[model samples]
Target chain A: MDKVTEEELIGRSIKGDRRAQKSIYDALSPKMFSLCLRYTGDRAVAEDILQDGFITLFGRLDSYAGKGSFEGWARKIFVNTALMYLRKTDALKLSGDIEDARSLDNGEPPPGQQIGYKELLKMITSLEPSSRTVFNMHVIEGYSHKEIADSLGITEATSRSKLQRARLKLQDMIRKRN
Target chain B: MEDFENRFDLEVRSLMENAEEDVPSRIWDGVSSALDRKKAPVPAAVWWKRAAFAVAAAAAAAAAVFLVPRSTPDNTPTPGAPMVRTEVPVTAAPALLSEAVPSRPIIVAAAPAPAPAVVAAETAPQEMPSPETTETTVTKKDTKDQGQTAKVPLSFNKALFNKESRPKDIGRISISAGGNLQSNGSPAKMLTGFRYARAKAPAKAGITEVSESTYGMTLSAGIGVRYNFNPKWSIGTGVTYSLLSRSFTATYYDTSSPDLSVTGKTDNFQHYIGIPLNVYYNVISRNAIKFYVWGGGSVEKGVANKFILHDSSRDIRLTERIPGVQWSAGGGLGVEFAVAPNFGIYLDPGWRYYFNCAQPNSIRTQQPFTMNFEIGIRAGF
Candidate 1:
């Protein structure tokens, strides 16, 4: 027998072929989830987003423009699903003026003061969704200040200021414990 | 492009990638179930059949309520309440088509339906007994009424026997006090029923005045069910495990003894697992408790053995004795009483044989063969 091709699999999936869809999920869910974590800032949060995004993919597989890369398209879908969850839970309520957000001088804290990747997750999960999202996009996702603002429907300056404030609070928390 | 930014992104992603977090078990089940839903699409025909069955059941139950007389008085306070308007009849139809056919009649109701009579009796006045009790009374009455059904046993043998004759699925299993029956003399109407008369056998039956006794009666259980068969006849077979046993003790006179002593002593025993097959004639099936009896072959071949046991000062010694093949061939008369046209009980006096000798006519050299009896209440589908 011949090996199955990717394009054929995707086409079959669009036509309600469940096996094709499962094959696709199996092949791509882990990589797509890796990208999702950069945006959602937490593993559990990222998985929730991944599930919702896959549901959308199966429901609307017919709308693929076939122009942009499939990975890029799926990445966007995952980001949107995460944001949708945030929106439903009222977790993203950005209220401060743009001036309140500012870049801190201590952007590069001492190695020991800066929480390790694993420690940071515990702190991130504890943050309000607004703090987590800003911390995720601006610091973790490598999104520029302007991009974070545009994506979250907040001003670029506000995005920067929230990031600074979030970091400040986390630093205080780290200090009070040690 | 910022140095700190790229490192923060890396750290965040690493944290998120940690493999230690446990996923809930249901997540896998939910995902798999969702995937499975897309693969096997249920056919509309199956749904339609189920719906049709439901509708037909509802209609018939409504009709039974319109019919079947309520025997108990109106002004009675009842105890224990059963569901009143269920579609299940007291008996089940035979030859379980949807389910694998069981050897013993599987009281037909898969999931039981409430009998209108049981329900009527249940809510009659709170003074009336529960459907459970009503069901029990129905079974008890059925057990006692096997004689009436014989009047129409031949005419409505199949429908009346398997379909109409047997009771609904006995929900719970029960055991009863173990009983014994001992007798002598060969049955004239044994294998094929009471048809031919014996040539020189005693006229007043056999085994002059043997006693039917009970001991260790332990369990009692039952269930509620409804019954019906469509298009044609329903036949069923059942294996009865009654823990039934019997022993014989009598005078043993040995002229060969040195003193020609008459040592009044005896030794006899039998343990059997019986199977009954019922054939029904369905002319008046829906309500008639009439059918022919063509069963009593123990579900499988059996061996009836005896032991000459001697009581010693310290322990009793056992000497094994085997019987012949003709004795193991057991079948007999069955009479049923259909209470709800669908449910009832039966009394089977099956012919079970065991001789002192294992070989045919081998016992002729030793002595005459000793016979055993088994009579009990039978429930069918």
Candidate 2:
């Protein structure tokens, strides 16, 4: 089988070539699925968001400029799709952690216990949807607090408070596990 | 604190950066099917067809009003004054004439050259007597032949006055109670937030069928005053208390928890107190049955509402104070049996479409149209 280049595949898909569209889906679906799952925390919802993201991407395929990585552009679409699903369900509303703020500023790691990648992912899932998104974008995805606030349609103070609460909650969970 | 934060960030990135889950093969099929549906957009032809149907329905209703035989009189009835016209043949028996005219039917003027003398008879009396008494005592003797003009005080001719009316000749009031079944137009699309993945059932199996959605019954009770303007036309106004209720099962997937869904059997109840203004025309008046058509509008205030969601977790109850007032315009046909001259049993079947939305933000808000069918007894003076 001949290997089709990304540009040629995009051009073919734009022309309604089913084979090329399938090729694009095969190459990109796994990574996008992971991103959706992180945001949704449920397999069915994640899959739904993934399919919706792809539908939107294909519909607006003509709008994509060749200025950035195609994968980066696709990732942005999946993130937005997940956010919309959360908003419709009111999952992005802030939790009551602000009023229940207890000190969780432990300076040192728990003795003789190390957090594994699976445990870390579990911790992220346990946070509220709004707090989880803030934590992911600011701490892992390299978005500034201003950028997070702007994207989520919340104030910078709200974004900051959510992230602080997420960190405290994660630390409390880790200390208890240790 | 900085060291701890860096360690936590590193763990998150390492777990999330290259994480991948298997893409379900069925998803491709779903996507392709959705794409196919989008490609074939529903045309505007269906809309045009619906409009044509609605216009035809409206035209039929209008034709019915004009074609039906009308026997209602032309004068509005005054509470203390009896002024009505009867359309009985001059050669009719005096006893039959007395049976037809419950109020004092008198000839006010002589017949013109081209027209027969029109006798005005107020059918409803101030305080109506029993059918046996009314039949036995009413006489067709001319009021003027007795040397008493139309100005002869009702007190002087008390027995001549229809007993259905009060002694002073005030008109009559009728009260009724009935039940109705209403459709809310269409069910709203479900907004299930999330659903846990489950094993797929066989394609032909009907395991996923939800419960049947059904229309609900509403109850109404009212008291009204009917004033006969003429033999063929009458106008009425009344206050009614209506209790409207609808129950349905709504299924929603829980967003906060994975693999959790709830089926809510919700019962919504609303109370409205309304004043209705209506005009009725007598189409057929036989020995004991009177068939008429009435069209009216009601101004209603929502007094209270209750929403109960019974689910697997726990029942949630909400009491809402309905905001704003609503009004509806509707008409229907009615048949009344004169069990007695002043007491009758009536069956009224009508359609009432609300002019404004009721109970906004609630399930009761949709389908502002209702089909009302009521059967009750009427007592009038």
Candidate 3:
């Protein structure tokens, strides 16, 4: 949607126009659900987070001062919702270092063996919760180590180590699949 | 190794950042229902219209009461001592004369012209008259004794003539209890200093999120005394106790060795003792029912203000004294059913608005206008 139409939709949604709310929902739910699934790795939990994110979005819609991209602002809400869930479930509790999966990470994928999106998503989701959170925040979401540390309430070193471990695990899973 | 890691991250981001998946339809249903729940409270405009209708209805009732004429019965004479006149027939003149005149002989004055028979009874002393003190004058129009007039002293039973025009002195003592229904659309406005603390804490401790405050139900109970000045109006004053409550959630980040965020929930309760003064106007009073409209104001002092915080690890409680009085004004209609002559049950539904009292944040401060329904029993002596 264009900026003016999007602003009008938001205005109507804030005033509790259900049709406008449904329009915004229909436009944003799929992408937001995908983000939730990437963070949660469970479809049910992802749906829950999606619902909560939309609720929080509508509740605090007035705070959205048309500053940056509306999509970006909405994306942050979904991200925060997912993070809140993970924190509530204690899924972000980082344990001591895991056994290095470096030995299993064979050099590279065989020639002509390309990993598709579903397979890569499966591989990422198969990782442990803490590593998956760190990987999603750092790699996919483009969060720096300090930002991830501050967001997840961990030290920069722990965030970096979790990211490294997650990457090795994904590499191993891809190598095995190939 | 770093270059390889960077390449892998870039490839994953490219695949995942724009990922979209179909959402189940049930999620939309849930969102729709939640929105409806949030929108359940009657809008401010609708409430104002309702209030206007109520006021108009009360005014109409008052007008009806004033415009209708009241008829006094013949047997029940008007109160206070007054000269009463009655026509006596010639056939009954001898019996009335024999009964009314004491030992003194009736003095008869004869007139030449024929006239209608008339008897006038005069009672002395503006106060109630004794039987012996009342005087009666009798005139007889008989063909045989034309225009015969006689002065006779009459005796009246004090009880038969002592009827009051106004209502008797009535004082009522009542106990009442009720709950207020408040609109949930408005969130409690936090105290400025408390909100500042929360805002500053998040920055200092790297805490990011705080949820909105939600208010709970309010309850009140009280005892009152009302004095009826007349049949149409009464004034009442009472002491009441009220409890108001609300809660919110805040996420706190500990910047220590094992950095972690804790979500804490806080519930605030405020207790108040108040005195209300109201004036009631009776619009309709029939055999067993009385309908009235009352308007009043109250002043409340906060007695206890407490906060309880609960987190995953532990709970913390704090209490602070809030100074200043909360002032509120309201009006409503009441219907009272008298079970006995001196005892009655009443229901009053009213609207009230609380004024800002320079106190800490609370539900009253957030949604100051509310509707109240009270039911009680009153006893009059």
Candidate 4:
């Protein structure tokens, strides 16, 4: 077989060449799988999201006009796929549009950045689904309040308020750890 | 809002960027099986121009055979979906447009392009007046997308049978997207891989020396072109990205005394967005099976030679960057099935090795070598 170039491989994948499809799957599986895992926090669920996302990738590969970065395009697909799965699983309570937790005057402890990023994520995951989801979408995924509102079908103001509450809860969690 | 949010965003962004999840092992097996499975048939997008011509002629036949004259307004569904098909410019055949594609939707000749040719497919409503409409759109999608999906066909002889005398165009692009293996049952290899065989691992170690993971997943997209030097050999180059993060759990041994096992990992998430210039010496093919050898170099960033130390508490990370240009060489073996003259699919199991990332003055350098393996397929002009 001819030694294929990245453009050629992606082009063939877009063209629906079955082998090209597999080639794409092989090339991108690790990162996409990891991304799915991050959103779902479970491997089996992540795999489900990965499979569904790839199909979406192939089905709609035609729309990719070589405009934005292809990685960015694929990243959007995986993240959206995970979010979709999350929605189907949890009626998307965060969908009610909440962003922040009203601030509470919680005192701080001696700080040496005592927590690792992984430990912090674990703590975030422990929060109630409502708060965790909002914190994740806004604070972690970087979605705007209005964008969250559109996605979850809630008011933008509600999204903001929910985010505030999530932050307060997260702060409490961090305090308990200390 | 922007002020506090930006500060908050900065903290979260840094954390997310370094955040590595302790994922279950099954995730690897699941994704691998998915990738290893046979690629799905996407309505079988064949050689578009060829398929288009075939479909265009067939569509003409269907139109002629099924033509119903201007019937009552009730007979023609009101506000029906406009049949959309676009013109394909063929300099040789100026009149082909009228025969191949109608000027526009039968009524809205002067109206807007029904939908962008690309998006018009999925977003297209299914309740349109005719089932034949679906076929027309499918045929159009197949034909008009030549520029979008360029599969680098490996068969130069196939190119020889072409009707034209011009050399093959180098516009074809091939991309490899996903799939990776954490380990291939290479237990000894896994334990003693050339990365760091003798170095003191994380600041903590346990009795059993647990293994974290040697996992890598990537989201890569790049384009390349080939110049057919002859019927057998060609030179090609393109850029690709590799977002790889692999980890391993090691028990720390502070002077051989016992410490509990803690997971320590190294994440080498590199964006290998560089040019790969290569020369291919294709093994002669009999029918379906063929092989080729390729050699090249990578000009990339974020790719590194490093030893990251996660503190005993896993609290802080100190990075030691040993940077250099990585020379790479690899070869391939594969088989191709001819699905269409302008298109075909081939699977090549490829292996590659990288030099120059070997730690200098480190006695264990040669024992801990790193390389990459990939099997990809391409289809195009």
Candidate 5:
């Protein structure tokens, strides 16, 4: 079968073409599913978020104003879908100032021990839910502390504190692993 | 510490950029099935048009109340009604030169007690005889015995006298409260294509059936204000709370197995707030009795509904899919009796047809009309 263009697929999806919808799902679900896993830290929960995001994407295809890349638009939807899932599950609880937790050393890991991308991701998944979200949004996604604070309904100081606490925890985890 | 954190962030960001995994096939199955169950979008209601209709109806009613009565003539009393008669002196003949005036005095006849003294001014000239005739004029002896002035037959224009004798305008406003009884005018099919899962059956298997529906009698109460533009014509509007209800029973057979069947009964109640704009024309306006024909449209909103499924094991609450806004147009004939100057009672029989069905569900077909009868008391001012 010939591959349809993204714009054509979106138009057909808006018109409720089942084949076109399936095609859009096939093209985006892999990368979106991985993104969901990064946010949720569970394969099953990631799959659920992916399914909901795709459903919402197809349902609101008409809202895609064609001003930006469709992939970029779809990425935004997946991120929001992850956030909504977290909210629904009561996992996005913003409690205790990041400063209230005992601070850890931000020292370099013992020099000989090397950490790969896989090990770093595993370290991130182990942090508290709120800290994980703030760290991912601010560091990986390039969001400012103020932007993260507003989106998460927390204060800018809280976003900064969570990011700082997350880095300290990762340093400790990396030191222990090494 | 800073170097370790930088290294950790750099590694994780790179991992995230390259992370990808194949979506499981089962997710597609769930989505496709959900899509299959989705129905087409319902047609959107044009709210502005409905508002405009309501406004225009109210405006017409207001105008009818204030304007039409000015042009309409007042109620005319029957010719048999008692009237006061006065006699003119013979010296007044020159003043009676106009054709409308009588050259002779009008004789006030002695109508017995308890009888209205209606002067038959329309009676022909021969009926009056000559004013000087001894039989027609009161004799001097009788006038002296009664201690009253003598009366004589008078010639006058009957049409002018008839015009002047009409009853004065008795325009009034009526306030009424009534109970309305209603039933579907057409038969409705219910529980149509109802599907239930057999607990023991495999996934995606169920029983489907078309059921028979019978609606129970629905009763509504309403209060209204009516302006009698005249006795013969009026306009009215009122708000009513209506509770409509129906029941259905059906035998469902499992499609896959072909032998498993079960009978189930379901009932539902719908509550609506209906605003009706009506016009009434009295066909017969008598002293004690009146008959009128009325027609109008109503805007109704279904506020709430409840549906229950009854089986031997247990009753299950089913989700009810009710329409948000509905419009119905109807008319009827009414009869009223005026018991007092300010109070009357009435009964009305009418028919109404809903423009569309009240349910947004795909399973059931709807009957869009009802036969209604209402009775109530009306108070007028």
Candidate 6:
């Protein structure tokens, strides 16, 4: 959609026009679903998060002042909704010792270039829940360790440790697949 | 090793940057159903127009009632008859003698001797005549014995001498208390659509669950003053205080862990102070009873609004002061029973419609239209 049409759609959606809301949802839901899936491995849980994100988006749509990209603004809501779900489920409670991540490194060369996108996503989802969350926040979303820690209510060191463990686990899986 | 780590992170980020997965169609259906259950926003202008229309209609109706001519007994003397003072005897008729035995001077229209007498003016009667006796019969001898007045039967219309007179411009101060006859349920459910949305959640997922809602009794009390412009029409204004409350419990079950659930209970209380202006039309008036129909509008401001939420984790209490005024208009029937000459008690059973305002969730906002009953004592001067 053109910028003008997108702005109009947003205006109408804020006013509770159902067609406008559906249009926005159709445009945003796919990417948002993928984001939810990356944060929550289960398809059913991701679907629940997706529904809640859209609801929160429409509820707080009035706060969007067109200062930033509308897509970015909407993405934040979906991310927050996923995070809220994680917190409520206590999915971010890290287990095991941080030193355990170093043992899995194995000094192996990266096999990322040979892996397909689907295989890579599968490997990422296969990581433990807390580690996967930390990895997604720090690597894919460009959040700093401190930001991830603050968001997940964990220490910065713990966020870094989870990310390292997640990366080692993913590399190990990728090497086995190759 | 560091280069390998950098390459792995870069590859993962690039692959996931534009990742898009097809969303199941049922998620949109759930969202659509949830939006449908949400309360539609009411523009402030529309409610203002409605309230203005109500107040205007009420004023116009009251004006129409006041403008119509009232039927009163014609007490003016016959057009051409000259008024004369004379003494009339009450001895011939026993009823007249018992009523007015002592002859007193009265003004009567002069006519030929022995002609029927026309009473122009007489002393105010102590007792009112019976309805059946429209005209009092005075024998000719009653006047003949005096010889000073015409020897005509003293005839008069009893209604002209009615002892009980209709009061005008009566003022009344009243104190009233009443409650809503119907329950408005929980305002949180009405405002947030939380329960409805949770109900529409996928059954297999079993993502959301809510408990039954409990609502507190809605109550109101006020002190008012009314001024009767005439015997039939009057206007009233008063300050009223209202209290509304509701509570509900909600429990959400996690899809991944069915055994784990979060439960929360919410309680809401709202207090409003209102000023109402009403117009009343008396439909019936008998010995000491009156029936009236009234219509008017009111503007209320929320003085205090509080929401309390209790969950397994923590308790949250929030107080929000809504800035905008709440508008409402309605009409109902009322009856007043006079306990004394100047003191009466009244009952007003009426239906009221509350207009949506900027105020947060409350019973008034949840159920805009409600039936209320009010009882109070009124002192008239």
lDDT of 3 at B241: 88
**Tens-digit per-residue lDDT, A1-178, candidate 1:** 0133667777897877878877777666766665555455677776766665566556445655566556555555555556555654566776543345333336554232355655655666577668777876665444677766655667776787788667656655665556
| Model 1 TM-score, all chains together | 0.33
> Ten residues in a row with the worst lDDT in model 5 chain A?
A104-113
Give lDDT tens digits, candidate 6, residues A34-143. 99999898899999989977876776676567876888777766776777677668776768666635634356656777777777887888888899988987788777
Q: TM-score of the second chain in each model?
A: 0.30, 0.48, 0.51, 0.38, 0.47, 0.50
Q: Chain A vs. true chain A, TM-score per candidate? A: 0.67, 0.83, 0.89, 0.74, 0.83, 0.90
DockQ of each: 0.03, 0.13, 0.22, 0.05, 0.13, 0.22
State TM-scores per candidate. 0.33, 0.43, 0.52, 0.34, 0.45, 0.56
- In model 6, the clashing pairs are none
Which candidate number would show the highest TM-score if scored against the true structure?
Answer: 6
Task: Summarize candidate 3's per-residue lDDT along B336-365 as a digit string, tens digits.
Answer: 754544556677768888897776656566
Candidate 2 predicts chain B with a TM-score of 0.48
For model 6, state the Cα shift of residue B362 in Å. 5.7
lDDT of 4 by residue, B229-326 (tens): 65456677766664434444332222231111122333332334556776765554322223455666555444543334343234323233435544
Docking class of 6: incorrect
**Which is superior by TM-score, 1 or 6?**
6
Weakest ten-residue segment in model 1 chain B by summed lDDT: B200-209
In candidate 6, position B154 carries an lDDT of 32
Lowest-scoring 10 consecutive residues by lDDT in candidate 5 chain B? B197-206
Higher-scoring candidate on DockQ, 2 or 4: 2
User: Residues B37-105, candidate 2, lDDT per residue (tens digit)?
Assistant: 444423435433443454355445534543343343212223454434233323232334556633443
lDDT of 5 at A148: 69
For residue B212, model 5's alpha carbon misses the true position, in angstroms, by: 31
Give the lDDT of residue B244 in candidate 6.
78
Give the C-alpha interface root-mean-square deviation per candidate: 33.2, 10.2, 5.5, 16.4, 15.2, 7.1
